[model samples]
Target: MLVLSLSTVAFLGLAQLADASGSPSTGHRRRTAGGGQAMNLVRSAPNSNEWSTQQWGHWAKTQKSSLEAKYGGAGASGTGVQKRATGTNYMTNQNGDSSYFGSLAIGTPPVSYNVILDTGSADLWLAGSDCTTGCSGVATFDPSSSSTFRNESSPFSITYGSGQAAGFLSQDVVQMAGFEVQNQIFAVCEQVSGGLLTAPVSGLLGLAFQTIASSRAPPFWETLVTEGAWDEPVMAFQLTRYLNVSGVQTLEPGGSFSMGFANSSLYTGDIDYVNLPVTGSYWVLPITSISVQNQSISPPSGQQAYAAIDTGTTLVGGPSSYIAQIFQQIPGSAPGTGDFESYYTYPCDTDVTVALSFGGRTWSISPADFRLARLTQRECLGAFFEIDSGGSSAPSWIVGDTFLKNVYSVFRYSPASVGFANLSAVALAQNGDASGAVPSATIGSSAARVSATGSMLPKAHRSAGIKIGCGLLYATSASLLITIAVAGVHSVLL
Candidate 1:
């Protein structure tokens, strides 16, 4: 299956969600980034605790269309399952696989602009200095003002699941986290769909490999690493938790984006390195198996299952067949009605446990991280949707933030592998869980149809993603979803 990826700007990693635990690999040693430098990520967008039926339905619509545009349409919607312990949230921190925000300077003299670091797609784009559209109040870049800015003849345009962006290509120095990449190619987007560019965040810093790059230039992070800025070509993240719990929540506490090493303070125990397929550009890993509670889901004969670890993707999507299988095991779960075609809804209080393995170990997602939103007091949306990618070499699953916040994630380039570990008890203590006791559903009513509004994701947003193996780039809507932020170490299976 030549499966592509779908993503939000800040997503990915594993825990009990799939190798999100205490698996120790001797060769996997941890180190601090060169110069002890760490890239600080700011929390820019505010989260919406309110997710009405209309919003859920709209999410299903845009997400389904996004998938169909590439992986073909999915079957009828399936049921839902969940066990979170918190309130409503979108993909921004608070442990619901939310968007991550940070600042990086581009152009010769260096002008800092807020950007979202994404791992799903490969492109670095920012708002042009021109006033208009999405670039409104947010900071914009002026090509003429920078002495080192180089112009390219190529016109730049990218269409996402919800909106679109058009601009031109340019080259300049991109410096972030104390590391600088000279003459890095990026997009200076002039026109953007509304709601895409909000205050504090003006562009996307895609961390995916160059093969998928729309501008066809080397990625900023990769360039810095290969250029000998660091001995290890590794980038790791610990997204802050803002979901349920008591008292005031600090927006950016505990959440960090780092390069060349893992933060020991954020996670506990040793990290395990999972081997990835060398044949692909995006991060693709094999899944040993999946299960709902105690029931194991075996793929059809000759079928190979791979999960795309995308930090930029906000939601977790998989084959309809598998999603259906997952919900069938959870009682009181059903497909959404009306415009909610690809999403599933279930009793908010069901103690449903979903787990996945990648040959070496199995991991699980906390119930809080599994629940996307509440359509009603009794029924809520499941974070995992259906993307129906049923062919060979394609990714059967796109693992995004919903599963990422449960564990500390590490993406390394040299060996070309991904790793995960349990969040330290201290880190977990500060973050709250999304799986609160939402009113339990009365089976029948839980399956009722819900209304919809517009796409929750924004223009050129990389929040919810589905990346194809090779082709043109398609965009996804971006929004904030909050659930409980639970991080813990899993006992080694040995």
Candidate 2:
């Protein structure tokens, strides 16, 4: 079946950054741009071909398990914010399920490809001209077509939680918006397998540090920073949500991303900043505590843990025991009946306050965001799931899009840190419509723009924030194992 792998977290053992030949730009250059450069982020309509089957849910589960085994539970390690340069921001397009993509041009004349602007992993890869098998709808990058393409001697291979890609490393001119980075190093895949074949993307551009990159090359943003492309050294994300418009629930492409500086208009309150520790090649944040409805929920181990913020992850994953503890408080919450053994379904409109504290401040998620969908007349599935990373001591949470859509986030570099602010009133329209009722008019008067930005490869998971229909898509079948991972804090959707 065709699937949208989108952004899956695939964890590679942490390593030192590799040196690249004839680099795009040196890091010594100083940037001068002063204001935030904003890019339009569009959300694509869901694909029926993908959602109609149970494959996505099963794949997500598998990917999630993979992540626990790779970097969660016991093996998960600590994680980078490097000095950034003045860079041009590019527009992002949301694809099926967990995928948010953008366009970039490569080669001499510049051939554009629709790629995932993932902050989870730190490698850039696309189908090369030689990929004839399983590469049907993707845009392939050809070295022969560019005058500036430079071939590297090193062979490259990247493994996601559910798929794999292998090829040779090469360098060329990479372009975003109107900006260009000369001799940008990237991987050109001659072969791809598993869930990646079905993903609705041509390639992936990882935004993390070089430690986790498969090709070991500095990310495109790093190259931009080295070239002194920004007035500031930051990126921000204003992830949009599913809106009900004119009595129809629509997932519109309405989010924005900014580079170099923050867009004050996208947020309502002050930006709360926190230091980021690059423990294991990820933007890992220390969690002070977790509370449900203002009451603290203790984990099975009663130990404090950290959370890795990942854009590539679809769902918010927690330890199995902690997840059970959190959901136990909800009346009528019970085990799911299908391939989703790792998930639970609770009563519709259940009132519960879920919050995570990072850097001493707590950010609460709306109750409305918890409901995945109605299972029966009064039952609704939840967005949270129980995942066991064999080594319980590893970071216990993979905070994904479910929580991200509710806030405006900034990813700062040089001395890596993460910042959060309350989303503007306009961006909160989806949260305000708690009933999930489709409205008669369009929502939001102005475009919702924000910035701070920053990977993993796994079989991608579905976002819990999107509404699901109780149809043939979720029928119970034989037991299917679910798992996940990403390169740095690589996580899966459940």
RMSD (Cα, Å) for all candidates, in order, is 14.7, 10.9
In angstroms, the error of model 1 at 401 is 0.5
* Model 2: lDDT of residue 241: 57
Name the candidate that leads on lDDT: 1
For 1-494, candidate 2 gives per-residue lDDT tens digits of 00111123211111111011111111211121234223344332222222322654554455455444334311101112233333323232232223344446677666656554555555567778898554555557788999988887566654444444567777886665334556667778777653343223456566666655555466776655544455566777776654212222222343555666777767877889898754435566777767886778763332336576765555577767778877887878887646667788787766767888786568887675565444456766677776554444444566666677778888777657888999887556633232532101111111111111212223133111111000001111121222221221122221
Provide the global lDDT of candidate 1 against the true structure.
0.51
CA lDDT, every model vs. true structure: 0.51, 0.49
Cα RMSD for candidate 2?
10.9
Query: Residue by residue across 1-494, what tens digits does model 1's lDDT show?
Result: 11234434222111000000111111221123223434444332123344457755654555444433322211011122111110101112322334555556666566666555566555677778884675555667899989978886466665543345667777776655444555677778778765455544556666666655655566766665554454456778766555333331223332566665566777888777797865335677777778887789875223347676765555677778778888888899998777776678889888677887766567788777677666788988787778766454446677766676777888888788888888887557645433321111010011011111111122344222222321112111134321111000000000
